[model samples]
Target: MVKKIEVEGYNALIECLKENNTGTVFVHFSGSLDENGVNWCPDCVKADPVIARNVDKAPEDSIFIHCHVGPKAYWKDQNNDFRQDPKFYLRCVPTLLRIGSPQRLQEDQCCSDDLVQMMLEETEENVTPRY
Candidate 1:
């Protein structure tokens, strides 16, 4: 079964990562809504169910995180760490990444079931070191 954890901000998400560093982790970034309850990024909304459907392909011990990066006003800020943080450097909403691994699916790629499965099931040999 896939364990899903929802986080609302960058610091909270980072803290969760630090505590769960050993096992497999799938991280996704998406834009959140304001008091009006409207999602800013349509892509993120579209990717949600696909991510839910494919998350079970991950290892048994793996964890999945759905991170809400805040409203459009926050994400649109050029100085946002969501775009500047090297660990993430997220260029788009609905970006999915395998923690401690190089596998990542961006933009429309995140909707591909095959690619998401491959990212979740990537073996040690298949993971190319980032640096």
Candidate 2:
């Protein structure tokens, strides 16, 4: 089973990243809801289940982070740290990336079970981070 760490806001996300410096780190950036329990991004909603289903495929001792980027108003801002950070270069919600790795799946790609599985199982020797 994958070790899942769900965090809200950028500060918490950064802290989680800091704590999991070693081992496989799978990060998912998604739109969050308020007290009403409504998601801001539809695609993110669609990808959630797919991600959950393939979580177990991650490398041993890996950490999975689900980072919620708040409501649509905050995420749509161009200056959002999650988007402005060159390291992440987050262009859209439901973006999955391997920490310090080129492995990334975004938008529609996140909806594919096979691709999600492949991303989780990727190793240093067999796969290289795309960015």
> Candidate 1: lDDT of 33?
71
**Cα lDDT tens digits for candidate 1, 9-118:** 89989998898787778898878876878678999778877877888888888889989998798888988878888888788888999876667888798888888888
At residue 31, candidate 1 shows an lDDT of 80
Top lDDT: which candidate number?
Answer: 2
Instruction: Flag regions of model 1 displaced more than 4 Å.
Output: none
Tell me how candidate 1 scores on lDDT: 0.84
Best-matching candidate per TM-score: 2
RMSD of each: 1.4, 1.5
How high is the lDDT of residue 83 in model 1?
88
C-alpha displacement of 43 in model 2, angstroms?
A: 0.5
